[model samples]
Structure formats: C-alpha cells, structure tokens
Target: MLLKIGLVVIGVVILYVVVQVLLYKRDMKKTKEDLLTFVTKNKKDVSVTIIENDDVVLEWNADQKTPLASTVKLVVLFHFVKAVSSGAIKLEEKVALSDIERFYIDRTDGGAHAYWLEVNDFSEHATLLDVAKGMMQFSSNACTDYLIDRLGLEKINDQMKQAGLTEHDELMPLTPMILWSAYVSDRRRDAFKKMSGVSEEQYKSLMNEIFNIMKNDPEHKKALEEKMKKKNLLGWRIQSLLTQKLTKSTTNQYAHFMKLPG
Candidate 1:
C-alpha cells in the first residue's frame, strides 16, 4: 500500500512539471507574437533581444545601428571614473562654472534641469563628483562639456574603443557645447549667408568667430549686437528654428555604464 502511494505522488509531480513547461512555452509564444505585432503596427525600426543563462532567446533586428545620443555620456563617465582611479582627477576637486554654464540658471527660461546643483547651489563651484553626478543624473549638457574639457576627449575615445565600441565612429569627438553650436549654426546658416554675403563655408567660419567673441570678448559682443540692431538684422526667429532641430532621444543611454551582476 505504501509503495502504491509513493508511485502516485511521483506521477503527480511529473504532471505538474509538464504543465509548467507547457505554460511557459505558451507564454513565450504569445510574448513573441505580441512584440512582433506592436513593432509591425508602429512601423518602428528597432532592435529587441532577450538572453537567458548565456543563451540568445529572442532577437529582432538586434544588429541594426541605433543612435546612442546621450548614451555616449556613459563613455565619458567611464573615462572619468578611470581617471579618478588613476589619480588624474580628484573627486573633491572643485570645478568652477563659466558664464555660459551659469546661463541656464541666470536665464528665466526653463532650459536647464537642476538635478543635483542649482545655479547658486555651490556658489559658482561644484566638486568633480558633483559635476559627474549632474552629468549622469541630470543629463546636463553643460556639465558634460566641462568634464570633457577636464578629461581629454582622445583619452575617452581610446577607452571606448578598448571596451569594444571600435565600430562606433563620431561617438567621442563631440562635446555638449560643440553639438549645441553645430545645431545653432546649421539652423542660422541661411540667415547668416543673407546677412554677411558669404558662401556657406565662410558663413560657418564667421559664426564661429562671432561665437568666440561672444564667449570671450564682452566689448566685441556688444559691438556685434549694436551692429545687428543698427542693420535691422536682429529680428530673425532663430530660436524657433533651433526648437525644430533639437530633437530629444527616446531612450536613456547613460545606464549603459553601470556594471551589472552576472
């Protein structure tokens, strides 16, 4: 009687295991179908992958190139962390805010997201750690520009390449200010050409010169402003054009820097 009861228990356990396996397979099939349907309906050019226990479970266009956007900041942070480890930059070292960096705070516009430090949070100065935190946490472009200046771009690029991003070109050469300036210059190129009577190349050079003067020489900036005002060329709606060009990224790429558990 005892032997028969033991056999019945084993049969019940086997049935339960089979049922669980079947349910799992059904759920997986539904998940795949749903994902494919959504991607098809939305017409999204995306890559999705699922891995389990060192195995590729599902992949759809996983090899397609996707723009990293602010995700590139992870490379910057990776280098920054390395520099700190190598005794190149001290964590407590203070980074002073430039006039342009402070513009986000001074301007009443809702452009900057003060995640870690306000305009006056540290009185025109924040520690390297604070800047790093701001760059990652707030995605502050200005903070990124400052850190890039502190840690050479070439070093960051080398670090990224060594870490298996060898195929990604044009990922490390741009700083936040450079990207912003490029975007603005592209938007204003036509207007600048009409105003200066110069070719596209010449117009870009002149814009760079003007940008330098505005950032460095206050007297020259005032002169340029007065000249524009006198010539009635100061009323172009450049800001609206900028709005059209500053496209936001859909995903958070900064999280790529984190060392995940295996």
Candidate 2:
C-alpha cells in the first residue's frame, strides 16, 4: 500500500513538471508579432505603439495612460549611465550587500532579487556597476531601491524631463506595492481609501514616506516587514488600485523615449 501511494505521488510530481516545461516551451516559440497580436487583441487593457525611422508603424491606445510597471527601470538605467559619464557616480563605488538587501521585499518580485544574487554570486558586497547591472539585467527592485537611496529621487525624475519625456510619471520606489498592501491588510485603511485621496504630490509623498521608514526607522520598518512576512496582503482590489497608481505614460510617449538620444 505504501509503495503504491509513493508511486502515485511521484507520478503526480512528474506530470506537473512536464506540464510546466511544455508551457514554457510553447511560450518560447511565440514570436514578437504573435505576442503583440495576443496582447493587443486579447489583453484589451494594453497601450502599445511601434515606431520606425521617425514614422508611426503601429499603435493601439496610443494616447491612453498605461501603467509602466517594471519598465520604469529603463529611466533609472538611462540616468545611471549619464551619471557615470558625467563623473557624478563611479562604477567602482562599493556598497554593502546588507544595505541593498534591506530594500528587497521577498516573493513580490517573482524571485528576481534572489535570482540576481545567485547569478552574480556575490557574498557580502558588490560594486555600483554590478548593482546597476543587476537592476537592469535582472530587473531587481532591491538593486533599484539601493540606487535610488544613493541617487536622489528628484534627480531621477529630472532625467525624464531632461530627456523630453513630458508625459512620463514621476519615478517612485517599487517596494511599497507590497508593503502598503500589507498595511491595508492590517486594517489601517482599505485600498480605495488609500488610492482615492492620493494626488501626484500626495502619492509621491506616501511612497517617500514608506521608503524613509525602511531606511531610517527600524522598529516601524520591522512592524511593516512582519506584516508582509506573516500575511498575504495583495488582493484583487489592491492590485486594481496599484495598477492605477504605478507609473503611467502614453504609448506614444514610450515610443518617443526609445527615440531619444542616449
């Protein structure tokens, strides 16, 4: 009886792994055009534009405000390059690994932070250059928040304007999506209450407020961290609210950004 039960469990595990592999392979076979068609047609909540040689090639919801999500990291990368070129920040500047780890919220980033650390194989610390590489290459939010602390948020937002990205929303720290959701779970306030009253200035302020606590106030930060660690806070409602708040820009603006001088 034991042997039979163990065999059944093993078979189930094997089947699950095989299904996952097949799905991954199927997704890998999809071309850029296939992806675009699928997203634009099926995911009707998308804003996309394709520009070639200063000419508009394709567009959908071109002028509509679209959430940037992780794409906001591109702005960070652009600014980091400019800072290095202008002799503002050195590539060799070393940062303690613990400092970077502090900003990392586990499980929210789809394991990006852990994966970056694994691939880089750094022990206690890494250079600013490697950190920046992790930020762009791995899309690590931890790596980004570290840079944001080192480089002022105001300066980063100024890069968008300097690059003629008038439509781009202000850059805010990314970890708050998880932390603030946890706050809502603790019954401090609901998602709608938090989002509805927030203007651009108020939104930016709240983001900075959370980020400051993470950097400075250990006890408060610990409480928030415990909330995240102990409970699952993100629900459909908070996610919907976040989708509205997480940086937004038009499809045309995104394409325009790609055309800017690097």
Candidate 3:
C-alpha cells in the first residue's frame, strides 16, 4: 500500500509539470501570434517585451529608436521617484510658486485650459508629489516645464543619459517669441539673445535666478554640479522612419498586446 501511495504522488507531480508546460507554451504562442498579427495589420513599427519568472523576453529591433513623445515622462518619473526614495528630495516638501509657474498658470487661465492644473488659485500650494503626479497623469507640459526649470534642464538630460536613453531631447521652457525664433533660425544662441534683447550680463543674471530655483533641491544641485564637470553635453539622436527598419508594428501591436479578448 505504501509503494502504491508513492507511485500516485509521483504521477500527480508529473501531471502538474505537464499542465504547467502546456500553459506556458500556449501563452507564448498566443503572444507571438498576437504580436505578428498586430504588426502586419498596422503600418507603424514597435517594440514589445514580456516579463515572467523574473526574466525578460524582448521582441524588438534592437538598433531602432523612436520618438518618446509623452513616454519621456516615464524617465522623469523614475528620476523623481529615485530622488524621493534616496531621501534626496521629500514628497511633502513645499515648492514656492515662481513667476514662470505663475505666468504659465495665468496664461492658461488657472489650468482650465491646461489639464495639469489641480487648483485655479495662483496662491494654491502643492507638494513635490503633486507636481510629479500632474506631470505623469496629465502629461502636463506646463508642469513639466516648471519641474524642469526647478530641476535644471542639464541635470534632467544627464539623468536620462545615465538611464541609457541617449536619444532624448531636453527642451527648456522659453517664451513663445523665443521659441519661434529658435525654431526658425539655425543660429539659436544668437537668435535667443536677439529675441530677448537682453545684454550678456543681464542674460547671466536671469540664468542665475533659474539656477537658484534648481539649487533649492539638494539632489538637483548635486546633479547640476556633476553635469558641469562632465565633458559631453547630454543630447538626443534623431532617427528617420524612412531610414530604419521595424519588424513589428506599434499601433496594432500595442492595442492587441494590451487588449483583452472579448
């Protein structure tokens, strides 16, 4: 009777293993088919990854890179969270309203025009987490600009480089007038100076104010200092759709991968 019990236990174990293997294979096949079908259906290119059992499976054009658009916010969120986790910045730390933030809020009519604003009052106070959340949830351009100003554009770009995303642009907040000129003119630095009509000395002074706000956070300050000493300025690489190859389609693949079968 004991021998029979041992055999039964072994049989159950074997059955369980077989079931698990079958499930895994089925899931993988479904995923691959879904990806291929989506790619074929959509005209755009994309990358996909699956994580299971603490292992990552990537299906993508390793050499291909694309514009992140709002996806870049994920990088910002990661750095912000890391700063908080490392005790470099506090979630509850109060950030005083700057003229730029106030101007942006006012220009947009208390954020009613903008999705990022939680409160209409310019006097409304907020914590770092509030700003961070607004940035991620709303993809608030204004909030992102404010945070970038506070964090220092150079530092943010440096963090991006460290995170292994080298092909990302760090756009600093500028006036519409300046933005237009910068966009149209190849001589950006000179065009900026001409558009602002600020003397070199005055420009330096303005930069000082911006830098001062960034220095308020210890982590931001440290990152700024480190960036200044670095030889290479953080920059993004431009990729053209016509020049590159994409094995998978982005639009359909993303939808199919995320969608549940009804």
Candidate 4:
C-alpha cells in the first residue's frame, strides 16, 4: 500500500508540471496575438522596424522617409557616444543647468526636462554624461539641444553618413518650430501655411536659417526660448508636418543604425 501511494504522488507531480507548461504556452500565444492586433490598429499612423542579428526581422513602412520627431535624438545620442570614444567630449565634464535651460521652453516636450530637474537634485550643474542619460531616459529636449550644440550639427550629420545611414536628413536644433507661428521674419509665418504651400527644400532651408542663429548667436537663442515659452500658437496641429519635415529617416536606415557597434 505504501509503494502504491508513492507512485501515485509522483504521477500527480508530473501532471501538475505538464498543466503549468500548457498554461504558459497558451499565455504566450495570447500575448503575441494581442500585440499583433495593437500594431495592426495603429499601423497607418506609425513606422516600425525591428532588427535582430543584422536581419530585418520585421518592418512596417520601412522604406518610407518619415519625420523622426524626438527619435532624432537617437542619432544625436549615437554621435555623443562616438565623440566620447574619440576623446572629444569628456564624460565627466561639468555642464551648467542654466546653459541647458537656454534651450528649454516651459511647456514644450511634455514636461520631460522638468521631470528630470525634479528627480535629479544636482543643485546648479550636472555632468555631460548625466545630461546625456536624461536625454534618453527622460526624453529631455533641453539636454538634446545642448548636446547638439556641444557636438556640432555638421559633425553629427557627417557621422550619420559615416555610419552609412543614407536615409537620414540633417540634424538641427529644436524649439525653432514654435517661432514659425507669426513670430518670425519668414514669409510663411503660419506653420500650416508653410506646410501647405512651401516645397520640402524651402521648409528645410527655413529651419536651417533659424537654427543658424541659435548655433552662432547666444542672444537669438535666448529670444527663441522666450517665444517658445508662450506656447499658445496652435502648435499641436503641426504634428504630422513635423514628422514629415524635420530630420526624417527611413525605418530601414534606423534599423541598420541599431546594428552598429558602439
């Protein structure tokens, strides 16, 4: 009777293990199905590329040149790492929060920079590496813009080509988009009008002109911040235009960018 009970106990344990395995597989299948449903629902609005081991494992709108918006920071982040590796930017370098604020506007960026400030009690300054972390971690536009200035826009674009990212558009400063709302000297002061009427090349030139002042002149940078702080200029309407206009790249090239050796 004791021997029979022990065998029954062992059989029960094996049955429990098998049931758990079956449940786990079912859950995994459900998760994949859910993810596919979500992606299919939003595929019209998004570009997605997933790469593994230098292979195009998945892609949607991969060849379409799409505006990167904040994801442009990925290219900038790549350049920052390259600069550090080449001994150009010291990781421990001191950076003033005041200087970063020059590029920051109060309401833009969905409070990313503000959130970074609240959590990091750096007093007056933080290191370059820390700021870079905030760029990726918090999506801080201020940190991104500051690093763009520090890293040099020309060099950033050059490195994009060096990385064989043929689909990339030129890297430029942010915060200038708000200035296009009847506040600037351009003919198409209204953002939507410019989008509707101007050629792609013209719009790009306009952004370049705005960024040049921010790049070369400190006073213009301060002026830009003040204007952007106003933030009441129907800016949300230009979301689609921004993705098409600003520093666009194909999902394909960015997929390749992901495969690069750091």
RMSDs, each prediction?
15.7, 12.1, 17.1, 13.7
Q: Which of candidates 3 and 4 reaches a greater lDDT?
A: 4
Candidate 4: worst 10 consecutive residues by lDDT?
1-10
* Angstrom error at residue 234, model 2: 1.7
Ranking by lDDT: 2, 4, 1, 3
lDDT of 4 by residue, 52-146 (tens): 87667888888888778777887887787777767787878999887888677667777778878887888999999778767766778879888
- Residue 148 lDDT (model 4): 89
Candidate number of the best TM-score: 2
Q: How many pairs collide in each candidate, listed in order?
A: 0, 0, 0, 1
Candidate 1 residue spans exceeding 4 A from truth: 1-38, 41-44, 50-53, 99-112, 172-262
**Could you give me the TM-score of model 4 versus the true structure?**
0.75
lDDT of 4 at 144: 88
For candidate 3, what is the total of clashing residue pairs?
Answer: 0
- Alpha carbon lDDT of each predicted model: 0.50, 0.75, 0.45, 0.71
State which candidate has the highest lDDT.
2
Please say which candidate is ahead in lDDT: 1 or 3.
1
TM-score for each predicted model, relative to the true structure: 0.54, 0.82, 0.45, 0.75
Q: Point out the worst 10-residue segment of candidate 3 by lDDT.
A: 234-243
